[model samples]
Target: MLRRTLLCTGAAAITAVFTGSLWHGAAEVRPGPGRYGPLKVPDTNGLALPDGFTSRLIARTGHKVGGLTWHAAPDGGACFPDGEGWIYVSNCEVPLLGGASAVRFGKDGSIRDAYRILSGANLNCAGGATPWRTWLSCEEIARGRIFECDPYGERSARPRLAMGRFKHEAAACDPDREVVYLTEDEPDGCFYRFRPGDWGDLTEGTLEVMCGAGERVIWKPVPSPAALPRPTRHQVKEARHFDGGEGCYYADGVCYFTTKGDNRVWAYDAASATLGVAYDADSPLTGVDNITGAPTGDLYVAEDGGNMEINLIAPDRSVSPFLRLDGHGRSEITGPAFSPDGKRLYFSSQRGRSGKPTDGHTFEVTGPFRNLVPPQRA
Candidate 1:
């Protein structure tokens, strides 16, 4: 039941002209798959899924047919609702191979459309979805920029260079305040915020670097694109030296961001403009990547390194193993996004020693968050 409306050439031009204020129309509400619970994957490279969970090949690398090229290596992703189907915007981290592009998949698991969103950007890592229904794909390499891709349109995509380009990892937006928060992938990277002058426009915004400590630390602020010199780390060299900020999410008047190298999640209060450690694992075995809030207020963290498993940090500071790779070595799991209905979870795992294709694959697991055997209680 997937439906696609092809825009006429004239209509497409008009849409691009009005892209800045495109939020005027009502956003369509989409439904989710009715079923829920753990999925089943017959072949996990000796890995294991939850009891009933299942895994199937949605797409793969080098499996070309016609003009459509397979995804070389999939990275960050965001699922956008489109008619009866869903537009799964995925990031292809390959650069030299030249197959990296944003691919859209239908609800029935068919390639609806695909486009090269960002060219010459290497390691297009993880990014967040904006309230305006766009995917912000980040580049992990030095001097990387964030690009906003409208999966609904074939040619309405562009890079948002006003967001203070750096080794961009992930970004989150506050729809009510029209503020966008971004994370740097550098070891000493500093957190950033962009306050757009216009609610619907992002090109003209006030960029600032976070400074100070706790409540005292404020978004000291920086020059806008017009006044600022060439965007480089040297201009804000003092902001460097972070523990490695990656995943970010905006919810409940706060921005929850994570540091993958240090395994810590910090909450920045939008009202007070202060950052504090929200969650940290007791052991150093967990390396976190993209993080998303569950419908019930729990936070799900995707593990990029260390042991292969998704960790759930409950409200009461109780951390438990939600999903385990169930094999040997690291799993390199990325993007842990929840379905709109919050019944199912979607994630991607890069190539491991199990010969599961270095190109990476997306997996879906269903089930309510439940307790597993604790990690031996310290």
Candidate 2:
């Protein structure tokens, strides 16, 4: 049942800035309609979707899908257009054996092929898609690095060490700014951006850490993106520290990211070099992890453990649960991305009902998402 009532909409009410310099403060943004309506009861697959939406299992860990054994602990993912069909790349968030895989779909939404895009990476967590159709697979380990993978499986994956050498979690490419924003999964991790020497070429780049507090922010070159002598975060004395940065996404001149430690969604306006808190712990959304936005201005944030659900943060800033995995209480929702046409969505349960990596399940939900209209203030 969708809530039709529209909440107040105006300037977000800033409440408090938790440490003055570290946090930009919390905001009470207005709530909007649950666009797709409330999630119905659990379906045949234990998924609660909207009225006209349905779910389908795409792949299960250790199971063969399109001739390839799906990897375990599926994490960050994205969809890329492939002619009349598309391809979905997902990360395997496992240590020692962590990697990433891709699944190709036909025009009829049928599985066409599945193959590996990246390998030999450890703790491959959340990552972002690039305009060039490459997937930035990030390794969430102490000495972890970023890998540029070809979603089409035409080229081999390569490590982009110049980006930085920390527990990298996610990357968001701001094509307009000619830089890629990244988030670290450390308790005191810092937000960063990598400026490649050549626009599409990420072979070499100058990694910089964010500094300052509040709306006005600045970037300072990271003494060593490789963290040779000192960790990148420690090298920048005045660099702002984020609480366990997780998923990241860039769109409409804003680079949006989530920090799981403090349960906040941050919006960095690249156009103005300003930063602000889009959502805080006070919102209905919690345990924020992987984030992705739609053409409709709706942002979908998956939960790591909060309710085993994917919540929608509407353009108006109102938050509500978009879908829920009914019986997978122990499991956390990972990747949440939409198809190129915006008619379908893809995501995964890192650890399914059994709470084991071997039981992970990647799913696809199809519905009338393309018709959603951003809620207006009442």
Candidate 3:
């Protein structure tokens, strides 16, 4: 039941950073352009955007986009190019019924087709896009795992058990180091990286947990990736504890991730083995969740609670609001992926105005994206 769309090939090295004061109490008021200007006001769709941007509802829970029904509780998402058009894959965050769906778009930003990419997965929360043109659909349960999905819908999705099974939150593939970084959503979750036996194969690999704090960190092998004797997080006693790991993304030479419990965004330099904070409560952004990078080197972070805004952290490290959802205070934003051309962005209001999973709403924002800027090596 899959529609054919020509798959386009490309590579992206998007990354972002922050270098401002730190705080833990409340969001601090900082001065920055926000790249775009001050948001005008909420439009008919209850969305506030910059001058040249406009928003449109793409799909809703139990609703049909193209010909297939959209998934519920849409969470992590990523964009994949298809010829001149593109495809956006969104995860379903509902257990048992939680899987993922894909919406195919034409070059003119029109919906061409929609279909299911993965099914029977439990609580597929947040996942990453692979360099080999696959989507990593991660489950958010105690023994959850990552499923490699074909965006083209030609192949069946497969579970990569080697990637470790432990309350998986998100996955980001670091092409430079040939390692896939992952996050867990537990109070004392551990940051992990998996090095596949082969560069593009996930069947066999060494699962290692990050251990250390401050500037430099190290990775220790997890004796049991399957968490047989104990939970994966507990297997590595020396692993650095990350409170509630959420979204994860890789760009340039760094891996960026968020810890919702701590309200902090972290940057890990693959080359130097260094770790640093990219954003904290000191900035305006809060309830940091799914993260994605822009062509201009800005990292867009969606909020799980605070203000229902998607904040942007520029390469210069300044924090500012990119977009905010009004009348949706009860809902949180999930997914924040940019179209392959960087001209459009897609995200979802997990609960929409009603704050119910069945009321989930996905939207698209079209605007002029500034020129691309490669982030300075961290």
Candidate 4:
């Protein structure tokens, strides 16, 4: 199941107004820094990084403990600082075919604890971390729902069904605004935003879908309770909801989102509620699973389908190869999160072994990341 790599070179002209006509700008680009270090993995079918980068086995399939078998599949997750140790909220795609179990990994890579967060959810894709430090585990199923998990690996977590259940993917929150942005994991997926009735109270919220012009799409507020029954053909037929949205990150009054089936990243303006395309890969960048914005305003995208690699898109809309996975070609990379100190980058690989019945692996890449560029004034 290995696919060819697709690379784009040269820079396309991009023009935008900075300070009226007083400062028109254009971006200069070149070929991306190609693959670094050894591109082939050894022994295990995983990835190998450069000298400073290292990969370890946080948890894998069939690892037994306390007479309970650890589940195989893993997906979207986030890392939180808990006391002296770090706590990771991992997602288990499903229980049926051994897709169960979320583990809390300590700093030493040992499982501090584990729990089955969601049992029946299929394709539990990438999720986001709430400002309160809880994990919003999303289910990428036909009628998927988002589940909130405690950092201690507790099974008491429940699905936030009020968030408009439909192929749930990544969820990002604007802590200051009490607003949450969500992405759908479907072809032509719609970008959704949820505003809690009260700050910190997620039980009730207003869910809306992004619609209208490409760069002027407004968050057409939708009725959450009415959207609960089941989505109709007309409801899911929008072009934006067609390929299904994936990763979502909100920062600096803007929301960054990705489409796995379309290989496109879009940004939504929180002030005006407008949506615009940020980056579009011709091919090879297909199947982008999750996207996260760095402090430098650049975006890091995890490639789930096709070639397994992590790509970075600069603020100037220049896309380039960042990291490449060794050996396994189908390791669905998701959940790209930067450490609080901005030193290390962490991501999850859902399917290290290609074919049906895939098991995921967790990896960490340490590197220096630049902050995102501030948005220009209108």
Candidate 5:
């Protein structure tokens, strides 16, 4: 019940290209009038939002946002709460053994049950949500890694692998400085950080890689964290290579990320540790998959297929769309989490519209976002 949007004017001055092969930087931040601005006219029936935003069909692909049932290809998700209800946990890309599933909304989002929190593991897809709340399911292949669920279904999700094993594709955590950023979908991807010798422990850690050296960026150290025949992005040749990453977020100290071959949207800066590409590729937005960090700091990405729409970006990188997707068609829109009271935004339309494969769906877009805090850097 808060959609008046119409202020628009901020974000747009990017030059980014630090792995596009060497120098080029301008990590500015001008996200003014944004909190969902000047853009709203689609949502024909399911996702085309903006006129005060709206969407609710929370859980499909078999139906049952809860009570178990909804499971089939709905990629990446995270939301946990209980005692008044809330527990999303999606991510089940399927293929050989895929895994991750859960549901049980009810603070008005309805649905009261749906299960399967982590299966055999294999294509799973995006993940991230843990300050100690938990929900880290990844596994995109090439021996992917990461799995730490416990969204109320209890525990036993295992698979930490010290947090290194290529192909993953989504993860976030800056919990003040416990560090844990990761994203890699191939095309030679690479952008990680683990360092968990303790403090909330994630089994163990050390997997560096972010190297750059010119405008400053270092953390290199991954001489085969288990590439075996070699293949952790060729065992990291100094780092800085992402055009296939597909989603990341580390908040506060900043670490946003997204790289679907080149639809870019990056931002490192753990206090000028420098690395910026805050939305480039000309910028009309394209297949940038996953990504979520909005209470107002702006950022929403998630497209994975070009016109499935969902681009939000702001904070001066200015981008729009915020919603679009005509009848499914090509399918793509994975995860996009938000809702620890950030006002509800969870996403997924992954493969529905009769593209069958069990179909796909998982929505809930409430309204008036903008509660975003934590952004006082210098």
Candidate 6:
């Protein structure tokens, strides 16, 4: 599936207020320049951001913005461009009460109305945005599934049962082919693909598991998507298995995914039906989870545990730390998403050191990111 490359150009008009917002000191723990290079000491928050970067507090537990109170344990998030503004959809990783939330940010960086988008799920972990402008919130539980949501908080959060039932981790949509790639949360979970009959219409699709390695591959159609008698990998022989697969992002004819169990990042090239390791697990920066692509051809990987830092993978496969977390003990960085304009990078501290469910915070860092190539308005 070799698709056209999107070369974004121009820049968005940034407001002074967006660049001036900041949060107060979170903990006493001071962070130093990360392993890769020296980053400016954060003047306010606890996030160890790059030298030219600054962070703003989006919303924390108990905080109310638009009549709706903030939810606990913010996990995955995606930013959608709206009329002169953008909507940030966040996933709440609660037990049985897990769901997703949406917050609208004005062009001037002001927080507008916020509301609950999806409800009644379990462990709504990570998700992806569709070319049709919907958010696919994945539930990370056995027999769990994915629900497509409209960031406007208007559409029904209906589960597309054909996407398959498993411990889904995250999903990425290839706008070119209108296909969706999914990752599973189990150690031996199978990598999946959902091919919709009509482009951008997910109502009906074929569920398949990717098998084999390298350029030679196979797409094994799952016999039963709603209730698999066995794990997808066990059902299909010769299929490659991902250990604790977490997040995925599709770009440049490839789908890049992470495996926390093996601390590795894998790329599946749809054009050639091949699979390769973009970042080997042997690298010092392990516990790879979420992944996002920089317009300049580089890939950014968020840590699920080990170093608790965001790792940058160059096009040549070299690695560096983009940012690190110190005081947020054990909290892994999740949902590394860029604003439509590419200026604001949004991510969250899943368990923020307080060890309380109410401590997870969602923060937005603004800076001159390499991929800050402003996207064209839709």
Which candidate has the top score in lDDT? 2
Stretches off by above 4 angstroms in model 3 are 1-29, 372-378
Alpha-carbon local distance difference test for all models: 0.61, 0.85, 0.85, 0.61, 0.73, 0.76
TM-score of each: 0.76, 0.91, 0.90, 0.79, 0.35, 0.87
Q: How close is candidate 2 to the true structure, as a TM-score?
A: 0.91
Worst 10 residues of 6 by lDDT: 15-24
Q: Write the per-residue lDDT of candidate 3 for residues 193-263, one digit (tens) a residue.
A: 99999998999999999997546679999999998979999987789999999999887677889999978
> Model 5 misses residue 161 by how many Å?
1.3
Question: Order of candidates by lDDT, top first?
Answer: 2, 3, 6, 5, 4, 1
Model 2, 239-331: lDDT tens digits are 999999999988777888999997888878787676767676545677899999887777899998878888887765567888999888888
Q: Predicted candidate 6: what Cα RMSD to the true structure? A: 10.3
Full-model lDDT, candidate 2: 0.85
lDDT of 5 at 252: 59
* TM-score: model 3 vs. ground truth: 0.90
Candidate with better lDDT, 3 vs 4: 3
Error of 3 at 364 (Å): 0.4
Query: Which of the predicted structures, 3 or 6, would earn the higher TM-score when compared with the native?
Result: 3
Worst 10 residues of 2 by lDDT: 1-10
Candidate 1 RMSD to the correct structure: 13.8
**Pick by TM-score: 1 or 3, better one:** 3
Candidate 6 per-residue lDDT, tens place, 1-378, comes to 111111111121111101101111111111223333665564466877776788887888777866778888888889899898898989999889999999898998888899999988889999999978999999998888899998998778988888988998899997766689999988788899999988777889898898775445788888878765775557778766778989898876778888887666766667656565555544446688888876766677888777777877665334677877778866878888888888888888887878677888888888777656744536
lDDT score at residue 319, model 6, on the 0-100 scale: 65
